[model samples]
Structure formats: structure tokens, C-alpha cells
Target: MIRAYAALEKGGELKPFEYDPKPLGSEDVEIDVEYCGICHSDLSMLHNDWGMTQYPFVPGHEVVGKIADVGSAVKKLQVGQRVGLGWYSRSCMTCEWCMSGNHNLCATAEGTIVGRYGGFADKVRAHEAWVAPLPDAMQPVSAGPLFCGGITVFNPIVQFDVKPTDRVGVIGIGGLGHMALRFLHAWGCDVSAFSSSADKEPEAREMGANHFINSRDPNALKSVEGSFDLILSTVNADLDWSTYIACLRPKGRLHFVGVVPNPISTEIFPLIMAQRSISGSPLGSPATVTQMLDFATRHQIEPIIETFSFDQVNEALEHLRSGKARYRIVLKH
Candidate 1:
């Protein structure tokens, strides 16, 4: 039986729970979770924010752990190997997207928490393909977020062929945005940060932003018109997207990694005349995740985090819900 903390009902506090897992599939592996990161998505699921969360929900996806068991068909990973798991647990390996190395786009991709118990536990199982090996240089204590938030931001840079010489802008200096700034800066881009918080200005610069644009300042937003080759919006809050669109250079792109609850509205003339584009994506593919790990290791990029014991799961959830996390939260066993 796997021991875990679970929310028995929607918006409920987590409590100790246990259950016997199904027979492990030939391609599956079980991880003895050492640490897990608390993502906003976990809080969202805890409250059934997406209306797809299951009862007795075990909400954690950014998992860093050692392999405890492996199935007969699993080849790349071995028992006792350190690895990490992210938002996805499984995907239809034969689909076109998966065959083309974009498994994150697989039509039947399984979310780690949608209908399954997740990593806020003593053990969690996933198809080996979705598990990423941790580099020796990456510290397990702070590596949990790399599997989710880190990869979410890193994938766009790889997918879009963001150039080192490109001018890049990042919105929101929270979890995803902070990492995006660091990655873009290390990639050699001229980085700008768009934030409404005055206190975050210095913090943004420390995170690698060369310019700070106050989102609330019309002059600040207007000064950068046609300035960016790419702008990555990492906030879930709705903003004046049209204004962001205007800030993009000709043939530029405004990409989203955040899940805004409302539809984004923008004028067509700005997009048509400038040849600008608006796009969004899920997490990265397995190959991309590996690349991200290697790049992060090479550049020494790590998420700023606060730690909590697994026993303090509810408190950690509340802290995240309160929006008080410095950048990320990790739960250790």
C-alpha cells in the first residue's frame, strides 16, 4: 500500500491516507518519493478549480525521488536511480505526436493527478518514459520544480528557436517567470521584465532582467513599443494583451505558459500588420526535458524555494494559496 496525504473532498484539508496500487505495468516504474514541489496547479486541484480533480486527491506533480521498483519492460531506468516526474505520467507512445518526439502533445496523455493519485506520497508510479533522470550536479532538495515549472519555461525557448541575440520580455516574476528570466538571460537574450510590483523591480534585475517595465505605467508600457522579439506571459491573471501585442516587433510572438481563466482578447490589425503571433503550449517532451536538465546544470540555474516536510502538506498548500511563496515550495520526506 502507498501512504499519502489526500484531500478527501473538494477544497478539503489533506489527511493521511493509504491504498494498494494496481499491478505495475511492464513499462511502469515506482518511485520512493524523497521530495515533491507544491505547484499552483496542486492548489487549484485541491479546490477542484478546474472541475476535473478526483476525490481523495493527492496533489503533487513536481516529484524528485529514487526509483524503488521497475517493471520487466523498463530499460532506461533502474531501481535506486534518482529521477523526477512532472505533470504527465503517461502518453500513447504510438501517436504521431509521440512518434515525432512531441509526446507532451499526445492526444491521450495522462495527467499525474487527473484520475490518479500523485506524488504527495511515500510512493508514486509513472510510465518510465515520463520520468527524467536527475543530473549529478542537480541538488534533489531544489530540483523538484525543474520537472514542472522549469521545463514549462525552458520548452518555449527550445520550441521557438529563441535566439541568444533576441530581445525577450517576461511577464510575472513569480514561479514560472523567475525561471524564464534566468534562462533567457543565460541564453544571451536582452531580457526585460514586465511587473506591477515596485518591490519586485530590483528582484527582477537580480534574476537577469536588463529592463523593468511597470505594467501599470502607460509610459513604461508605451516606451517599449515594437521592442521585443518575444514576450512570454507567465501570469495567470488577465492583462491588456493588446498592449503587449503592440510591444512586439514585426514578426514577433507573444507566447503564454500561464493558464488564464478568461479568454484573451486582442486586435487583429496589430497582428496582421506586424505579422505577430499569439501561441501557447503545455509542458515539454521527454527529450526536451532532458535537454532542459542539461542546460540548467551547465548554467547552474536553480529555483529559489521554501521547504516543508511532507507532514506539513496542508500548511504548504495554504502558503501557496496565500501567494506568499518566494518563488517555489518543496515538500520533503
Candidate 2:
């Protein structure tokens, strides 16, 4: 087995050390990681926030790597091809979600963190069936976040059949929100960026948003009432759905992709009043991931990221957790 450096979760802290590679199965491909994106879910998993977590966890799902070696059964991928692996690394292919092309929710869905060792290291093994080919338009390190942040935002936009002229509102201007703005703007929509912080206005506008609204102001809420065709929420903050619901025009759809650990205390009255619908989406289907890459390549759309070395993972995570990253953070080998 090859030895690579990995940052492990030890006593609630990540410490760097050597780890061994497991024997490759016929369906597995060994990858030499070029970049790994730090995800918010990694922090949640590291702390056992969702409860089922294994220790010594190597937490990263947004991985971009090169095929260093492949097992005999693998035919579709060749050595040296650049590829990206996302949150869902494996799945039970016969489930309803799989049959419907929504592999992100397969009940036995295998997250990169949950099953195999993740990409927070120099080398990783991934399922050949789950890796996506990188388009020529994206740089390897620059593309890591696309597997998570890009696919997460683009899937809901596609599932909703967002149109060119649709009036779109994106809440929360962090990593997901910034990417949402990029996608929505590129889709030819009238995009409005929402944030509770007034300081986010300049960067929000630079990301191609036509309007920037500070949701804390009562006047701002009044002007936005019934003004949106769709609202894609990317914030983890506790929300008063009534306020957001009022911002939607009749028959509008609101999709929430963020996770707030607290149960959403939303009232159902607005659902009946305006026939509005609320839904949640996980990362994209394997098929949709390919489509998103194609779109990103064609439109010259890419995420802005700060790069860190493999050993500096802790600093990167701290930056992300402390809300200092401009948009996304990635680690390079």
C-alpha cells in the first residue's frame, strides 16, 4: 500500500500524519489528488453534528484528481485523465432515487466520507462509476468546488426549469450563495442577491447580481413582497419562512439547499394562500454533474477560491468556519 499524508480527526481536532491506501477492488480507481475543497458538511461531520461519524475521518468530498492507477475492470477511465469526485461517491443503483436519476438521495448513498477515505490527502480511491470528467475550460484546483458548490446550486435550478427571464432571488452570500449568483446570472435571469449583512453588497454585485437587498430592513422587505419568481436559499441561519414566502409571487417555488440543525419552524398558512411550494435538494445526480460541468465550461463560469497546501488544512477549515473566505477554499497536494 502506498503511504500518503492525511489530516485525521483526533480528539475533536485534525492532526496530520501518514495513512495507508487500501487494496483496490476491480471497480476502484486510485487517484493522486490535485485539489480538495473544504465543505461545511466536513465540519459538521468532524464534530459528529449529524451523529453518525467515524473517528480518524478524512473529511473532503469535493475532490479533483488524476488517475494514477486503475483496476482491471475499469474501462471508461484511462490513466492521467483529470477527474472530480463529489459528496456521493457510491449508491445502491436500484433504489427509487437512482431510478429517477436523483442518486444524491439513494438510501444507502455512500458519501466519500462515510465509506472510503476522503480527499484531504495526497492520494484517494474512488468508484469509477462516480467520478466526473473535467472539462477543458476548468483548472484542476479551480474546479474542485464545482463538484460540491457548483452542483448543489445548479441541480435545483435545473429541476425547477428556471427560464431566461425568471426573476430570481438568492439568500445568503457565503460559498453557496456566491455560486448561486454566478449560475443565476449566467442563466440570463434577473438576479437579486439577499444578505443580512449590508457589507456584502459590493461583492454580491460583482458576482453579476442585478440587485442586492439587506433583508434586515423593513423597507427592503416591503419592496420585495411578491417580487420573486423563485427563491433559492443557501443560508444556514434560522429563517422566518413567512418573510421569504411573502417575497414570492403566487404559484412561485422556493427551494432550500442549506441545512439548519434546528427544525425549521415554518407555518403552513402561506402554502395554501398562494399555492407556493417549498423543497430541498441535495447535490446533483451523476448525470446532472456532467451537465453542470459542460455548462460551466461553455459559459466560462468558475468559482473564486483561495488555495492552501495539503498540510495547512486546519488553517483553511478555520478560515472557512470563521467566515473569512471570499467564496470557497481548496487544498492542493
Candidate 3:
């Protein structure tokens, strides 16, 4: 067995330490991690908030690594290949969702957070089907955030046909929101950033937001009513949908990738009057993940991130929880 170094969340909070690697299975490929993005989802899993967390859980899903070994039957990947893995670490390939090509929504779709150990360690084991070949030219640390944060926001951006000329509004300027702004701006969309913080205005502009809407200002929101062709809301806080919907153009699409711990409350006018749609998506299917990577490579689009050494994982998580990181936090092995 390969020895790997990692910090452990020993059924409560994360404490820096080491752990042993599990025996590799035939369908698994062993990876020596170069970088792992510290997603807010990781923070969610650390507390066992969703209630299925395994103890000594190493929380990470946005992973980039080098393939150190592959099972004999593995054909899709080879040893020494640069690779990336996202939220999905495993799924029943013959299941209905898999057959219907919507594995992301599968009832039994096992995640890196549950069924398998994730990339919080120096090495990880995962099925070949769940791993995507990372572009050799892409830097590992920067690419880690793309696996989850980039793809979470990017999948809908591509799926819903929000194009270069569309007026796109991104809500919240934190991890996911920041990436959404960059991706939309890079796509040549007329990007607008919505946030409560006045301080994020300059940073938002620097990240390619053409306009910054301070939600604290009524006039700011008033001017943008029915202005956006698409709105990607990334705030996890329970917010009034009417306020968000007011920013959308007629029949505009609102795609949600963030989770609110509480149920949302909103007026019916936004949906009933405008014919606007509200929707949510899980992370990308394995196929779409690769497509996102290729598209990002072609467009030179990557997330802005702060990197931390593996031992400093606790500090990394604290920074993310405090909302102090630029956009994304990555851990290097």
C-alpha cells in the first residue's frame, strides 16, 4: 500500500495528521495529488451536515493529480497521466440515470465525499471512469478549482445557451460567484456582479464584471430590472427570489448551483408575470466535465485561487469559511 499524508476530520472538526491508504481495487487508479481545491462543499461535508460522512473523512472533490498506478483492466487512463476528478467519484454505470445520460442526478450516484476518499491527501484512489485526463499544459494548482467550482458554474453556462451577447448577472462574489463572473466575462457576455459588499466592486470589475450591483442600494437594483438575459445565483443564503428575478429580462433563465440551508421565500410575481424559470443543477456528468475542461483550455479560462500546503489545510478551511480567499483555495501535496 502507498503511504499518503493528509489532514483528518476525525468525526468532528479537521485536525492535521496522517492516514494509511486503502488497498487499491481493480477498477481504481491510484493518484499522487498535486493539488485539491478546498470547496465550501468540503466544509459542508466536514461537519457531516448532510449526515452521510465517513469518519476520518478527507474532504475534497476538486482534484488534480498524476496517475501513479492503474489497474490491469483500466483502458481510459495510463500511469503518469495528469488527471482531474470532481464531485462524482463513483456511480452505478448500468443504472437508469447512467443509461439516460444524467448520472449527476442519479439517486445512487456516490460522491467523492461519501463512497470514496477524496483528494485531501497526497494520494487518492478512484475509478478510471471518474477521472479526466488533465491537459499537460494546464498548471495543477490552478486546474484543481476548475474540476468543481469551474464546472459547477460552467456546465449551466454552456447548457442554457447563455452566449456572448447575453446580459448575464452573477450573484455573490465568493468562490463560486467569482468563477462564474470570470467564465461569463471570458465568454464575452455582458457580465454584471451582484453583491452586498461595496469592497468587492473593484475586484469584481477586475474579474471582468462590466457592472457591479450593490444589493444594499435600492437604486442599483432598480436600474437593472428586466435587464439580464440570464442570471446565475451562487449565494447559499436564503434570499428573496423577487429581488433576483427583478434583474432578469422576460423569459430569462435563472440557474442555481448553490444550496440554501433553509427553504427560500419569494413573491409569485417574478415567475408568474415574466415567465422566467428557476432551476438548480448538481455538478457535471463525467462527459460534460471533460467538455468543460476542453472548452476552458480553448478559451484560456481558469479560476483565480490561493494555494496552501497540505499541512496547512486547517488554515485553508478557516480562510474559506471566513470568506477571505480571493475566489478559490487549493491545497498542494
TM-score leader: 1
Q: Write candidate 1's Cα lDDT for 192-221 as tens digits.
A: 999999789999999999999999999999
Query: What are the lDDT figures for the candidates, one per model?
Result: 0.95, 0.85, 0.82
lDDT of 2 at 181: 94
Q: What is the TM-score of each candidate against the true structure?
A: 0.99, 0.95, 0.93
lDDT of 2 by residue, 1-333 (tens): 544334355425666646666677787788888999998988888777788677667788899989998988998898999999989878877989888987888899888987456888777787787889898668887898999988999998888899998999999998899999989999999999989999989999999899999989879978999999899999888887778888999888788889965776667888789899888989988899999999988888888899999778878889988989878999987
| lDDT tens digits, residue span 1-333, model 3 | 443333355435565546565667788898888888999888877877788777767788888989999987788998999999888877778888888777787887778878456777778777888899987667777998888888899889767877799999998998899888878888899999999999989999988899999988988899999898888889888777778788888999777888887876677777888888888888888888888888778877788888898778878889988878888998887
Give the lDDT ranking, best first.
1, 2, 3
| lDDT (Cα, 0-100) at 109 in candidate 2 | 84
Name the Cα RMSD for model 1: 0.7
RMSD of each: 0.7, 1.6, 2.0
Regions of candidate 2 where Cα sits further than 4 Å from its true position: 2-11
Candidate 2: lDDT of 116?
53
